[model samples]
Target chain A: MARNRVGVIGGGQLARMMIPPAVELGIDLRVLEEAEGMSADLAATGVGDYRDLDTVLAFAETVDVVTFDHEHVPPAILRELVGRGIPVHPGPDALLYAQDKLQMRAKLSELGLPVPDWAAVESADELGVFLADHGGRAVVKTARGGYDGKGVRVVTEASGADDWFLALAEDGHGGALLVEELVDFRRELAQLVARRPSGEVAAWPVVETVQRDGVCAEVIAPAPGAAGRVAQASADIARRVAEGLGVTGVLAVELFETTDDRVLINELAMRPHNSGHWSIEGAVTGQFEQHLRAVLDLPLGSTAPREDWSVMVNILGGPAEGTLQDRYPAALAAHPEAKFHGYGKAPRPGRKVGHVTVGGDDLDDVVYRARAAAAFFEG
Target chain B: MARNRVGVIGGGQLARMMIPPAVELGIDLRVLEEAEGMSADLAATGVGDYRDLDTVLAFAETVDVVTFDHEHVPPAILRELVGRGIPVHPGPDALLYAQDKLQMRAKLSELGLPVPDWAAVESADELGVFLADHGGRAVVKTARGGYDGKGVRVVTEASGADDWFLALAEDGHGGALLVEELVDFRRELAQLVARRPSGEVAAWPVVETVQRDGVCAEVIAPAPGAAGRVAQASADIARRVAEGLGVTGVLAVELFETTDDRVLINELAMRPHNSGHWSIEGAVTGQFEQHLRAVLDLPLGSTAPREDWSVMVNILGGPAEGTLQDRYPAALAAHPEAKFHGYGKAPRPGRKVGHVTVGGDDLDDVVYRARAAAAFFEG
Candidate 1:
């Protein structure tokens, strides 16, 4: 029998979460991990540099299709994999937008998608002009290599990104920083969608997300009171972003719901994002399972919510002294209904080590339980 | 931080299913498989004879606790591990009952548990007397090594188990065959429970199980029409059995719901059983996760059902000509809400290779979808 195998390019928690659904769907998932004892260690068949074309090529050869754990796999390597006739989901063509914020801004603008007023500034003078045109303050982000609040800065002056500019010049690879107006928004919302190569798309309801220290802290599914407009607009924008970018696999479109009721794209992720983690226990089909189906070009599962409310809270920085297991007794005893998920990693300050999700009829109660369960891991 | 690791002694589908929850719970699970490329091959750390004390001990010594995928491990090896102070859930004494039908029946009878009239017959003449007393119709089963109808037989004559008796005599081991009066059951129900070493217990809703040729063919959670009496009786029976046998981890109590409004013990499994598989997609906490917690002595999760109705149907004798993936396109497209699960195994007649579960408000629709989805694998 010809077993269908899907190869993942990075060994992060995303890859680890995919193991369960893949196992259930009977898809043989193998991972090309970045290092030993990584999150997806069980499925890590090979540990080597993802940048090294030869190492990735060897791993890709063993599977029917290749997907990703993150958007960091060098586009050059991904293009090479495609050149060799190995299928890559969210192919390099679409991935370029996710890899570079400047590229994403240009593409979204060109596609006429709703996005913040932005410009690619290669010099301080350009950044100054954009800042003056919008407000004295703007958000400055490096074109590449940023995640979980890093590589992002709220700049009041052109000199705010002076260090980043100096580093860019030192690297000898000329690149521009993406500068955008810091739009006043009511709240942050995210729309998660999965697209198959065959153009089939499945979108979950828009969710409200709370950010602390620029990292995801909590998510409430369906973005309460978003039934008529917010939900419709967010889903539409996400579908457009996924279709416009020709992205395959899960696409998370982070949106800023302006004070004036306008929805604008804030960030784009071509892989399963933190905003969709609640779906593991809330949705009929989770983002991880849906991502696999999209990448494999299989029929997508239902995206219906299993309950009225599903709340997910991130367990950041884990424990101050011990592992997540040290707090399991207290957390588990407190909330048996909340599903606790821990990534196998040492606790580090500001690190997203795990998450807790609670789904039920009452949003307030669900939110409280999820937060209370995750709080146990704080120490 | 100290990591909690649990070692499993078998590498069947049950072991494979446990990997997902272990990953979610952040428990390190290592399996000692019986062969290369088994269902739980992803977690297989060692492959050796489970009957061998050295092999079992070496594997058991690495983890915080020891459990099983099946109840086939030798008692001597398990006792040796217990002697070495290794935490073994459903320890040797408990497993012995599951291993020997006569022992289980005698113990249950001694405890005054509800069971059919039964006796242990060593010879054909003894069996004849018992059969005559039971209106010349009795169910005969070997004392040990029985599963999925392999070691059981229904006889109307004295010579029905003559061959088994002959083999027992030839082996030079004195053992009696377990015989019981033919049960006129209205339906079969299963009560699943998880018990910790500390004596905490959690029980899922009793589920109606359909058996085809002595193999679990389908399951309906909460057993339709079993609200007041049947539900209470089944749960009480299961808890008593678990406490009486000193069983830990998940215990499956298969019951015969007779036409006369009586529930009798049919069989006992000291680990996660096929009857509880539906909980993976339907319950607030799956049996696999509950089993892991029970074995590790952690607080158990809720056993609440997530939906109104969740129907599960087994996929027996998977595609004969191609892999399970060959039928995925059709099955997946037709029933997107139905969760498909395939065990990584080759197709063989009457072999359980996979299952499909559908959860929704309507039982009839859910049952139809689950069965239809599972039928696509028929070859």
Candidate 2:
């Protein structure tokens, strides 16, 4: 009996989590990794460059399907792999919408989805027009590449757009720039869904995420009091986006929940994402496992939360004065309920090194424990 | 900061499950494997004979603590490692009781714990005496190094004991044998507990285990319909044994619940045992994490069941005809509530390759789904 082999393009925590399910399902996993110390380093056959066609082909030759760890893989390479009959999940067309914001906004607008009043603007004059239409304050973002808060800028006046316009022109960027109304949002939330090749889709409970300095700090699953109408709306929007885009893996829809309780689509990520990391221990089936099952065209598992409440606290790297384990005993002794996960990364200020998850009957207790445990490691 | 490294002396499923918590706690783990392609092969470093003192010493030099994945590690080797100041948890003295059944029974009897009436017999006359005193039947077992129904025989009459006596004499293995009156037991159960070096111990709910041909097939946490008195007695016995023997790790006590509802001590394993595997997903804190914390002298976590019930079904290797993934879709499609875990080992008939865990409000539903999912994989 031959196992279905899966080839992943990068070696990271996303790829690492996929391994547990791949082994469980008897799927032979092979990873094309850039370094020796990455998360999937133990399982992958190191392939130095993802851009090199020969290297990519060599890695794909041994597998039945090709997927990715991050969105940094070049689309041309993915298209080439697909052309050679290597089944690439979240194929180039669907990935393009996630890879390029200009394409995503245009497509969502066409789908009649609720998005911030936005337009692709290539020059200062175009940016001025967008700002004038939306309270003379707009968010200018690069259309092709950006993550977290990078590659985005808030411009309240027309004078501040000149430098970005010149940079885009000098870079010879072909993709149109985007401008959006700076909507006053209460908080950011994520609605995640998984779709298989057979069109079976599963949606996890919507989660509200808290960010500090543009990096995610905590996530509260089911988004507290979001059970009846609010959850239905968020899940419905995410399901539509997944099916409409023909996404064949985990899709994370980052949304803005305005004061009016309306969810506006913010961005799309086409693989196991950081926003869904809490699912590893909180949900019935984790996002990484769901992604593998969906992409492999297997039956999807339940996405229900095992507990009434769960909170995940990100452990950002802090000062390098002591060992992480020094704080483990204290944190575990105090909380005892927090599930800690470390990525084995060196500490560097502001870097995401690990995370802690806490679940219980009380949402406030879970949130407090998770946050305190995370703080212990960071401090 | 140096992390506490633990070197386990076997590479089976027990060691495999330990990897997750070890990695989570940033505990550097190294396994001394007996063969290639074992469950913990990915994390193992040295492959050598576990009985060899030199090999054990070489493996021990790299880690701060030495633990066992099985009970077969020679007592002499353990003593040698301890003599060199290597911290061998469940130290040589505590492990002796597990390695030798005669020693275990004698110790439990000395402690005034209820055990089957038995005697170490060296001749056919002694066995005949033991059977005559009972009901013309006796269970003969080897004194040392036995597992999974091996090294045991049932003699129904005097004639049945003659052949066994001849074989024992021919083998020149007069190293004491045991004959016991077979007690009428209703069912088998297991209670798991963890002990820190600081004398802190915590016990999980007693669980009833179902066995097939002496192999554990399923485990029901808190043991369905188990009397509150029996549960408390089982835990009390396990805790006292751990503290009395200075066992500093997770210890599993397999018990026999008789017609009178009295729990009898059957077997003892001073490491993470199969019966506690459900704790990985069903409990507030998993057994592996608890064991790590205990061995590291950290405070033990709560062992309360997250749900009212948890059932785990062992996935034994079936006939090697179709791919394991062939059943993945079916098993997953049928039971989305099942949490499947598979060890990365080549399948073989009767081998415990993995297990499935299910948690819910009802034990019957959880057990049925778990068993059905496991059977699906086997088929």
Clashing pairs in 2: none
Model 2 residue B269 CA deviation (Å) reads: 1.5
True contacts kept of each: 0.83, 0.56
- Scored by TM-score, the top model is 1
Predictions in order: lDDT: 0.92, 0.83
After TM-score superposition, the amount by which residue B115's alpha carbon in candidate 1 deviates from its true location, in angstroms, is 0.4
Give the clash total for candidate 2: 0
lDDT tens string, model 2, A1-379? 4337788889876787676566555466778888777766655876578878888888888888888888777889888988998899988889989888989998999998889999988777777888889998888888877887787889988766677777777888544678888978988999999999889999999999988877888899979878887788889999999988888899999899898878899888999877888888889898988988887888899999988888998888853767667677777788777787776566788887778888887988888778887888865
Each prediction's DockQ against the real complex: 0.74, 0.56
| TM-score of chain B for predicted candidate 2 | 0.95
Which lDDT tens digits does candidate 1 get at residues A272-374?
A: 9999999998999999999999998999999999989999999999889989998888788888888999999889999889999999888888888888889
How many backbone clashes are present in model 1? Answer: 1
**lDDT tens readout by residue for model 2, B246-281:** 788999999999987778888889999989989988
**How high is each candidate's TM-score?**
0.99, 0.96
